[model samples]
Target chain A: MTTSTTPRVCRGIGEFRTALAERLAAVPGEASLGLVPTMGALHEGHAHLVRLAREENAVVAVSVFVNPLQFGPDEDLERYPRTLEADLELLARCGADLVFAPAVEQMYPDGEPLVRVTAGPLGAVLDGASRPGHFDGALTVVNKLLNITAPPGPVPFRAYFGEKDAQQLLLVRRMVADFDLPVTVRPVPIVRDADGLALSSRNRYLDAGQRHAALVLPATLRALAAGELDLDAARARIDAEDQVRLDYLVVVDPRTLAPVAPAPGTLALVAAHVGSTRLIDNLAL
Target chain B: MTTSTTPRVCRGIGEFRTALAERLAAVPGEASLGLVPTMGALHEGHAHLVRLAREENAVVAVSVFVNPLQFGPDEDLERYPRTLEADLELLARCGADLVFAPAVEQMYPDGEPLVRVTAGPLGAVLDGASRPGHFDGALTVVNKLLNITAPPGPVPFRAYFGEKDAQQLLLVRRMVADFDLPVTVRPVPIVRDADGLALSSRNRYLDAGQRHAALVLPATLRALAAGELDLDAARARIDAEDQVRLDYLVVVDPRTLAPVAPAPGTLALVAAHVGSTRLIDNLAL
Candidate 1:
């Protein structure tokens, strides 16, 4: 019924929505609602977002659902971890006031949504290219979440997204703008572990040797973005590593995600398979 | 200032949104807001929908913008009528509380929206097949309109749509259901003329002779639906007419728009070019 830190835990949309409605009703038209959406393998990165929301808002809600729409048939949809019990405990410590942990049937009651919101050219490259039709699915759930949590009147609804998934963040920001959605997306800084590798749920898949190999990704991105190492050098360094198989290491325009001509204001993003664990990380140039 | 009907007229989104916000605030937590979207060529059919909205809700907002998204590139975007003064007067008589008559630039400030709501297989047949990418545009604007008029929380937002544009009505309904949008789509019965022809803005393009030829369309649809005439006989009768070239005449599943095998529960729709003007009409089987 409750998390350790006074957070109301709601299993159904109706339950959470009513809880949200009562919270919004207390402060009519005041934009104090903040939403942080996640696929529940909550780590320090998700905690950081929730903490930011707690500081910025009176009522903060965290949604935990592993969106099945965003995964390709061959991808790790089934393999994706479900750690709600742990996620709730983490969210409580991070100060999330409420959690919407709906069943898959609740989020998608009528099966696959026929009407879908698509990210155009921006979604077609980088992350979107390898996983075909991924952003469209991600966006469908994101749109629904935004709508589901959207305030009744002109009440401010601030949504927090992690820049760790850089392309996903960009697409979400654009979706909010294009659709004139009521919520403003606030990008939280990407949280990193002490060793400099970006913390990710997929990192759980890496063995001891693979974990050591995964450090090369952020290191390569950092060197490339800092102008200390050229892309060729970065690629060569990543290739020399034993376990990691390089997927793509490209410098792109931060907003468009198009491969740029190595300018100062670019983002160096890398994705690779560190012994069967596919991981992505980006660094601002 | 005011239309003949004394409704507040808002020319820009900024103005309309603020006005709408204030209007919705005065009656907080009550689902009294109703929206009827149109392209500003207000005929009796549009007025009928607006009248229904006025009767159903405490506050009714009618939007009159000729959406460029729904118009095909080579289609009659330029030739579309702009009768704001006349439209306002009609809205006033229909008991609309306010009108959002935004300019094209206001509606699409960023030019073409990169993010769009797409209608899938349901949008691919009948009128959709004839005008590729048409319903997507329709759904996008409809989605925008719904969001703009969406109540901050869940106080009830009902959208009125005419059944005359049968495919459009179905697609909007599906889009609402598919996205789990909060608004309810209330379809009004088709408003017809004395001689059984569907009321349309493009009907003005019909000359005396074209008007007479246009009667054959509705007549054919009616006879086919009544089972008094078979598809072949209806096509022959329509083809035997003057100055009218039938584009398509098919009986389809009303929900999916897939072509049906002359079943009872179907929709018989017809499109024809009477002179330089294109027109469409449908009847329930």
Candidate 2:
């Protein structure tokens, strides 16, 4: 997924550090630095985060790293998309001043880290139950990015994430508080296409029929949120949908991600397979 | 183990943050901030760290929290030692600028953190093996202290630690590097008494005879370093002592804390029981 586009790519840690330092220096006083972490293949969803950063920060750095730690051995570790060039173009349009796209070796010099940040019970449910060790990987790399991009002068360094990764956002919030990290984590609303399908890099994997079937994801979510579908009714919609296999569709406590009594203002989450690609979607009542 | 002495004690995270903010502001531009983390029961060894911090930084903060996370249920979590009054007097004599003494709840607002920083395989041997979850607890709270005390303006913050806890020091160093923290972790030389026994809070648990028996620790360290004692010979030295029980004495790779080929510039660690109290000591060969 390597693109031919460009936007000040920082291939190494030293370059990224230098670029970040120089950028912060150019801001003179009390600069608000914002970070948007992405795995390349940037779409409107990622741009939305960069745009919020651009609106709120004097300096914005978008990390286009395809973190290997977050990908499992059986998952799409190798084939996960990498559209650096196109991502750069999108970020530039969104006013991202710097792009940190380090090589795998640059981010992990000694290979797998000797120490790791683990997500306990909260991470073992929902999507975590489907993909074991996924949240651990996400937390480890996200923590690293938060640290590596930690502002030099404590002028308020914030990291922006999308609500599509609701669990990841919550975990990041917890990790920052638990570690007492000096960074603000902001979550952007989930972005979707005109077709109502939630935007995802994996959305590229869906065939025409699979793409149409994926629409049921948001449809079911909207129905559940609008009271048109109860827990059983949503499960029925997912089951009745063709060309897609439902993994799980249950409402959970947004804070701990635990299954609880369904009610308004709670979260309804779904995970399913459209052909060979897995998809997840969620909404708040 | 509650201490009766107080020196501007910060009871909660908000107070600690505000106190630290005020002290750091008092120093203004380019102020060097130093931190000394201790589990109370401070000795001259702890004072040595404060002295170095006092000399190196314009602002020095000492955290005195007896972290329950690092204490095993069966171990001395209940009686590790807390001499807050004496500890504060020592810090005052050392010219500490601020003392952050947070309660257990302050550090952990949500009970035990579900998200934990794990020490991986490095924490599985020696003291870690003897006391399961010890290193994990050490790493977790140490990381929290690091985050809680992170400089507001990056005026060159450095944390002072003693080398007496060689493994703890190494692990702290590892955690700092692993997390890319914004502060420098400074290691002070191991402070020892005239008798050569390393100073420790747990030394209070020793009786006169047990204290005398504890000298075998430093003696064997010196012997091993001088090439006068082999592994078996060192075991024999401890076996010959009375009122003291040898637990485990092995030379280890200072980097990984695993037993390795003994050599100079590497660590030789030992843990033994002086009466009912357990103690650990290490030295670089």
Candidate 3:
């Protein structure tokens, strides 16, 4: 099959909906749609998700919007990388059929939405505890994206997310189930660089020294996952790294995201600051 | 075109979804779906919504779940009317194709949902202030019902709501826009009894004298709507009723739900207690 060189870009919600409906209608019989939602600073991680979506469905649509609501007042909303040109190139190569890159105003025509999806108790702990209103904002935007991409017919619709954002993945999964959204969540494994640092849009902010120092996050997780370090040992290991300031390194039940005794299926989560950049990573133990 | 009587009833979420999808698939070329969400006392008001849905769409679905989330701690959750046998008879006569009547446990298998849709400031005034977290609960369940009834493919999904619950209808409209839900909200005019009292499931609780007293709500709204009484005058009219106790009588901007001076498009809302049952009514000025 010949692949298209460029994806049809949609800058507005109505345009995106119409484009998807027409595309779905053109298919001869049954058609499946796969969605890869991202705040586009396309790296191997996002491309990996798109590749999976392309392989699994008749049409692949990717959304690239740097959601402002997810970031705190003091957080890096302005400086977050937005490599749209490069993102389209990567998506085209990965066989994406469409890309919805809505502006903030287009997505939220009435400013911040008064009606929103709130992550209840789960949002109160872990990343939520550190970044107040972060998960709520994330869930709200994700909910919108899911509805925005929902198929016009009963055709299969699945959304792809990288397991790198474990808390986000869980909340989104719960949101779909809680709301009965007609979309499937297909989680892609975290993609790491050859140096073991998980790819993040903020990684662009890291200089050489901070980049090297950021490896402490994954390194500690590796030790914990390999049974070479307990929670205390992992905390001590990250603390010894002079350039990396340890935030929280705790073992949590993967299902509930609550701190739990380290067990086989529990997840080890770590967050820290390499220079001024905040980074997080996790591993299934 | 022939219509089926005795609408099919679905008691589980999965069952309702599949039933709707298959029904849509059977339609010749294009199909349309309309949903009427109610708490099942099958009053004339609900019948009005279902009749509108039947007239407008190829398939009409009515949800009859008595949502527990929408009721407050001291509210009439336990005593709220549940007349499924009669509800089905009314829906069949109204040409509804399906009825989703899931039990509380069927709807909330995981107990209380941690994540939910919240109506911010719009939910805080009028009825929301009197029943704290009421709109939040209402929006949460309504959001779920919208998702549950969302067409598999975009085949013109519309939800019918009675304007009797003015706050709720407005919030649902906002939620659809905020979440970019795939459904359109169609508001049917308030369905009042011959005596002018708005039909509500809770109306079943009012005894003979109390039912007559409840007419004060509609009387005040009618006066305000007809320009015979201003906000203060309407409040006084209800306040002077010996059997009716006034809760709040005010004029609010239709768009923002915030208090505003009476204008051409302003809405006058009244909430009062006749005996132990509370009733609310609204009229556009």
Q: Write the per-residue lDDT of candidate 1 for residues A45-155, one digit (tens) a residue.
A: 998999898888878999999999999998999999999889878988887888898898998787887788888888888778888999999988999898888866656
Highest TM-score against the true fold, candidate: 3
Candidate 2's C-alpha runs over 4 A off are: A1-7, B1-8, B25-30, B152-154
Instruction: Indicate the docking level reached by candidate 1.
Output: medium
Report the Cα lDDT for residue A265, model 2.
68
Q: Which of 1 and 3 is ahead in TM-score? A: 3
Chain A only: list TM-scores of all candidates: 0.96, 0.96, 0.97
Show model 3 residue runs off by greater than 4 Å.
Answer: A1-4, B1-4
List, residue by residue over A170-224, the lDDT tens digit for candidate 3: 9999988888888899999999999999988889989999999899899889999
lDDT of 3 by residue, B55-108 (tens): 899888999988888888998999888899999998888999999999888878
By lDDT rank, best first, the candidates go 3, 1, 2
Least accurate stretch of 10 residues (summed lDDT) in model 2 chain B?
B1-10
Query: Which pairs clash inside model 3?
Result: A152-B153, A152-B154, A153-B152, A153-B153, A153-B154, A154-B152, A154-B153
Error of 3 at B109 (Å): 1.5
My TM-score estimates for the predictions, one after another, are 0.95, 0.94, 0.97
CA-lDDT, candidates in order: 0.85, 0.84, 0.89
Task: Candidate 2: give the clashing pairs.
Answer: A1-A82, A5-A85
